[model samples]
Target: MDHQQLLSLLRQMTLDEKVAQLLQLATPFFKGADDAGMITGPMASLGVTEREVRNAGSVLGLSGAQQVIDIQTNHLKHNRLGIPLLVMSDIVHGFKTIFPIPLAIGCSWDMALAERSAEIAAREAAVSGVHVTYAPMVDLVRDPRWGRVMESTGEDPYLNNLFARAFVRGFQGQDLAGDTDRVAACVKHFAAYGAAEAGRDYNTVDLSERLLREFYLPAYKAALDEGCEMVMTSFNTIDGIPASGNAWLMRKLLREEWGFDGILISDWGAVKELIPHGVAEDEAEAAYKAIRAGVDIEMMTPCYVHHLAELVRSGRVDERLVDEAVLRILQLKSKLGLFERPLRGADPEREREIVFCEAHRSSARELAVKSCVLLQNDNEVLPLAGTGKIALIGPFAQSGDILGAWSWQGAKEDAVTLRDGLAAAGLDASRLIVAEGCGVDAPATEAQLAAAIEAAGEADAVVLALGEHAWMSGEASCRADIRLPEAQLALIAALKPLGKPTVAVLFNGRPLDLHGVADQVDAVLEAWFPGSAGGAAVADLLLGKASPSGRLAMSFPHAVGQVPVYYNAYNTGRPNVPTAPDHYVSKYLDIPNEPRYPFGYGLGYTTFAYEAPRLSAAELRADGELTVSVRVTNAGRRTGEETVQLYVRDVAGDVVRPVKELKDYRKLVLAPGESAEVSFTITEPQLRYYHADLTFASDPGEFIVYVGPNSRDTAEARFRLTSTV
Candidate 1:
């Protein structure tokens, strides 16, 4: 259908029908009642009748080919205009053949792998009848206490923006209208959901407009620029208003300024939440506010279904607003060719063939290996000898709960345990001594601790697989104390006395406070919830079958008090000097200001040495580009991949600037004894920042460019920007 046809369909919709199009219902609403033909489940409390349910434009959190086909088929039977129901679900990481969580994927610093993961997710979801994936959550996260940080890429705006684009491209592909394997991408938590106060879920976010535009908003904008089909409003309040009802943010900024004509859907129950946010009096007012603010669909809520029609009839909301939203919905349906084929890409045969297939699992295993970060390898304890008896201890040693949260379709039983991975990698079963040291968060019994110690004593070396349980992170699972449980710490203490070389393999969702664990273990591998193939990947890295190339996408804080520690923090008036006295400075009395591990910090089997940065010119014109180059050599015997990062700091600015901001980075594969000159072209736009007045332009000033392996340690050079054209 073309624009004219979509408009014609919208003109024919009644007030109730049009309002229903803006409401998304769950699957139970359409499923016929058991025995008797009465409608059942949670649909009654929604205040929606049978006709309203049939008229609902979309279904949330429902998949499976036959299920979707039956739902759409039943809805079309009762509908007057024969509009197909859109099926949407949370395909954040993967559908069935799960990959590592988004945070783990971010650590890879491999955009191509990120894109491939999204593509695999899309293919699997599309076959199962899912039309849109609420994914590529681009919120910039600094506080690990926020459970949803597992969904975001990381703290750096530049890195988040890159991954955002990659996810969108991979999900929607080049042409969403024609691609059968691709599912529409919904870039979500629209504004600044990641900046929740105290890192609590659904908390208020109070940020200066300058900071908002400079940091939080870039990734969302990048996703939109990449042609994501939908945007989900965050549950948090931006400034003083909830994002679902913020007209300035949704209409003026997203629609007018960003020119995002795509569909805007409210997060789950966010429409009714407007009343609690103090922005709306009741459901009626909430519907009016969200509709006026340009929300197209209200997910898992009755606000739009219960009050939108009444508001329209009372003249509180213009019927044209309803028409405009319905048109966007119809347009998407047309783009998806839903009217032509109600089942779209839903095929039972395809679903069976693609879900958890070997090829997809292979990709997952490879990417999982790339996502594991080698945080510490003191005395070269890693690359464990395969011939020796190895002790695999800790709760995750044989646990299959390696799949992180938000992977609703992934089953824990299908996961590869570390012991299984070791065996698959050709390690002799008799040589692998496994013990459940303790439960993920539960206390270990004396017998359990004794058994773990004995196993460690018998083995040549110990591989401690420790981390938070799968339920510890994701939505509504925030942790005030982001540290390993006391039980795990006790297990480590018990094993530390064994006098054996121990490797700490962390399987967590967020950056943890490893102050104690780091000292006890000879090697530390930060594996942020590797998915189905996590075990295989861990085994590969352990036996030197693969190199650890992943980096820290988020900074690992030294302690819980440093909740918001990041590399690109602002320089205060009294900055702490490392070599000078700590009096009257921005310093912590108990600990240093630096993080346990800085952003982009990771180690592989090999080592890299960086030469001092060099600039092609001392100064650059506004229209010209300056070339900055650095020579990096693999200083160790083995080959490895290195992420050479380029960061810039403005000497002076109209607004206070971060101490350093990542601008560009290149991940290079280097052979031992070989060196390569990595060059980055710096243009005037790279130096531009949002000023106090909200003007996004660069001011002529001196800038320092740093080239390094990680943010904390770098080689620097000076340059100048002449003017802004």
Candidate 2:
């Protein structure tokens, strides 16, 4: 309890206990109050009595460890200054060994397996007592009609700032106040809320503060430069205010230009949603504009427990802003020692021997086999054969709902499904044949399409298992037709006239519109919502015992009017050049401007190639650095894992840039006919950006650099930066 004992417990709390420590509320308002304690359900019209439910301080969502040790042992038996509460939840992507959804852990460009799935979801939410984990939602999404783009980690801002510093160093582990198996990582919808407008979830986001500091504030400033101890605030509205009231985005750019002295809070109920975002004229002017726009808590709102102690006793708010938000919530409950262990990592026998054990389901089956992406295989119809006869048809073939949609303690009866991963891979239960064939978007009747076309005309391989319905993709689940579900496309047009072979898999959560199930599948994959050992990592990547090294961290659009299609866009002024095929360029007269799967596409059951980008220098300067290289190889006969990527582009940019951008990548692995090389140093702060007077820098010209395996088949070269420090 330092900082002079948290400023002597914030000079003994009371302006209604420091406005009930900025108010949070939930866990059924301290489990359905009323023995004159009053606070009933839905926070009883927000007039919450019983002294703001015995000084709220924090609770939201709530978790287990003896239900947060019986709500901090009944709020320390209503004692006036004990202060323990805290709790928090929505442990995005697994609190019970589920993994694979942060856009399939950003298609496994594995940042150390996304920091070991955020350190095994901060050790199963710190033994189920959860001390904050709104989670690594580093919103940079290029709109997949924003149903929380499966809790973002895609459309690259340098790959969502490297999975937002690998989920804030795997949920604040390097000592988030001395980690008891860590948890305090709240980096969320703060700034751009994934540019909502029309991609729509909470709506309005206008952008251009140089595209919100070059692409949605670099994964929330790389999860507050990886120290992440909470941030939240974002129900949308940015350039016209609302990110929980905005004050130049939370007090002049997050506490005086990004110094972010942690704990901000507010997203659910977004402080009485500033009166439906017409910018408040109620709940005491949205609790005086979210505590003068710095919002330290206020989650399920009561507009800061009904107008923060009458706006701090009518001085128009400022009891030193409620003693600096109760001294950053008692300096985060004295850096979570919580006045010395108020059930810190609450045990319950370590939450039943660590939630889903087996070394967290073997790191959720090795991050669901590097988050399965394969995309399409064609004449080489995937590895399948474990003595075929297969045909596991639709409705997630023996569904366990594959844990998507903010898992919330995952456990569709301890998930595993595709017929329990092909009977744990030995396969033969009379050669498999499964078949729910209908419902992931309803309609399959004609006797479930003649028993899925007579079990794909008596199987010799079918696999199918379709998509969407873990409530069709996270938060408010968007999708204005993100395709694939006309009764799983009529059970894939009644098993594509049973010619056999098939494969598909899918199970989505955004980035779909797979041009009608990629022309009736010969292979496909794209397993986005694979969690809880997603059907034993899709039967070990369909019997080859694993390989499809994921990839496509967002960009599948073949159509949904290409709603914000991305692979680093911006190249117009009449550009669609096929040596100038014209009707005034930027083409799209009915399809084909690219992307049906691009941004670092994916494929791996062996095939690499590459070799054409070289350049150890053609000029760099401003504290020089250059490098480049390429090589690649595997070229087929098995062993895989590629990634490569790189990107760049500048050539003439006092402002119009992104015709390419990613910047750096690597991944590799290889083997058959082996090869390697790879390189990429480049420096000058990877050609800095944010210009148009926002001044991030880097100009003196000519860049190019490509080197690919994905952003639309690359291979270029050419250098030059030569100035701008």
Candidate 3:
């Protein structure tokens, strides 16, 4: 049926039917379970039967081959409208075969893997009866102290944009209208939710228009360009206006400027929280505000269900708005092929067997290996090749704390611990000396430190893995200081004097102040709390079977006081100038106003040399394009991968811009003495910015493009864009 025909059908429906299309329940209702297996009081109250919810709008947190089949079958055979229920869930990282967190995946700088991860996640999720995933969170966060940093791909807009499009492509595939498991992808947190005040989760986002467009909004636009089907509103307030009810953001920017045609869902309970935000007087008012502002669906918030109809009747909202929301929701279902073959996703054996199959597990392991970043390796102490008696010193060396945040389904029982991987890798458990140098959060015991020191003296090399527990940097787990908690640093200091080569494996969700560790340790490997096969991946990198191609997502600060340390921050009026006095300048008396480890900074076992950037054309018109190229050669003995980063800067603009912005990047694997030419095409959109009136357009001006290995170190070339319009 044509979309207009569907809209006509929706108009013919009765008021109760139209309102029923807006209802969303928490979980799926199964028929026999009410009186047979799992009897409960709530099941009896709402006439909660499998038949009832299957007839409703959609269900959340329910999927599996058999389960989805049963629900959709009911929709086809029993529901009044014969509308297939749209099943959705949080496939943040992986569905059943869990990969590393988004932060770890971001380190790969390999958009291919990110895309593949999303593809596999969609495959598993689709087989399980899921029609949508609330993912591809493209929030740009600068502060590592923010707990949800693990969920975002990175702080850089370019990297986030690339990953966002890749995720959309992977999840929805070539065609969402034809594929059963290829569900619609939701580009999240419609506006800036990452710049939370004081690095607190869901705090107010206070930023100027220049800051918002230049840094935060590009990635969401990128996802929309890729044909995402939904947009999730953020939990934070933008400039004193909660995002759940910001018309200028949702209606004006997202809908009008970006031309996004999708369902807008509020973050869990954000609609009702408008009362707390002082924007709405009550739940009824919040429903009115959010609906009027263009939010179509309320996730886990009863405000839409309880008050939307009342608002429509009271003239607070137009009835056409309700029909528009319902139409968007139904159109997404049609695109999911729910209308054509409503029971197609109901294969029981395929769903059960596909969840954690061998292929997904292998991909997870490969991603875990690729996501591991070697921050520093001195004297080539890594790739511990020879079969020697290695001393693994730390509680983490044998623990099951590798699962990063949002690991809702990953349990320790299902994970491969470090000890298990070491054993499987043929390392003698008896020969591998172990010592709990210190607790993850407590001071190091003197006796434990002595045992580790004594073991280091007798070992060929010491593998000292230190970092936070799995619960340290996720949602609601924010910290004032992101450092190696406890006395792990003290323990490392104690074992350093033993005159043995030490390889430190640091595991954490966010970046930490590791200046002291970098200064002391001979080698450092940043293996974020990887998922189920994390141990095996770390072991593979340690043995040199897989090269570490990962890079940093967030900047490592020198100390906690230097919060929000990132590469793209604006240059001060007297940047890098000798401060006349600390009081009058943006300088810290005790610390330098720079990052400990800059964004895009990562060291590989091998080295690469770069030739000066080559531009195809010296000038570009506002309506035209240009190609920027560079030759990268693997100058070291080992064959490895290097990420070529591209940064752009507007010399002068109507509005002030950052000193630099990451525009594009590519990861290349090269053999020693081999060189590869990587090029990126720049269009007018790359030069566009939000003016005072919030229109996005490029200004004819001089611009500089830098190509290099990371954000801090780069080679540059200048160009000019002529005004053609």
TM, every model = 0.98, 0.37, 0.91
Rank by lDDT (best first):
1, 2, 3
Candidate 2 C-alpha lDDT tens digits along 1-725 = 88987887778776787788778877777852222253454666777776787888887777778868877888888948888878888888888888978888888888888898888888888888888888888888887977889888888888889889888888777876677778888888888888888887888888778888888888888888878877888888877888888888889988998888878988888889889889987888998888888898887768777777887788888778768877887787779787888888878897898889888888888888888898888888788876768878898898889788999878888888878887878987788878787999888888877888887788888988888888877888898888887878867876787688898888888888876688977888888788888898888888889888888888888888877888888988888887758887887899988778878898878888887988987999989788998888897898888889889899788889988988888887878999989898988888888778888888887999898888889989888887876
lDDT of 2 at 458: 86
Q: Tell me how far the alpha carbon of residue 175 in candidate 3 is from the true structure, in angstroms, after superposition.
A: 2.2
- What RMSD does each model have against the real structure? 1.4, 20.7, 3.2
Clashing pairs in 2: 417-420
Better of 1 and 2 by lDDT: 1
lDDT of 1 by residue, 1-725 (tens): 99988888888888899988988977677753122133454666677788888789998888888777777787888999999988899999999989999999999999999999999999999989999999989999999999999999899999999999999999999876688789998999988999999999999999988899999999999998998889999999887999999999999999999999989999989999999989999988998899999999998889888888888778888988888898888988888889888888889998999989999999999999999999999989899985789999999999899999988999989999998999899887689898998999898988888889889999999999999988899999999999899999989988887789999999999999997799899999998899999999999999999999999999999998987999999999999988887699998999979999999999999999999999999998999999999999999999999999999999999988999999999989999989999999999988999887898899998999999999988989998888787
Sorted by TM-score (best first), the order is: 1, 3, 2
Better of 2 and 3 by lDDT: 2
lDDT of 3 by residue, 130-196 (tens): 8889888899988889988888988898889888999998898988877766778998877888899
Candidate 3, superposed: residue stretches over 4 Å from native: 1-5, 28-56, 70-79, 442-451, 578-585, 614-629, 677-685, 692-695, 699-701, 720-724
What is the Cα-based lDDT of residue 610 in candidate 1?
95
Compared with the true structure, all predictions reach lDDT values of 0.91, 0.83, 0.81
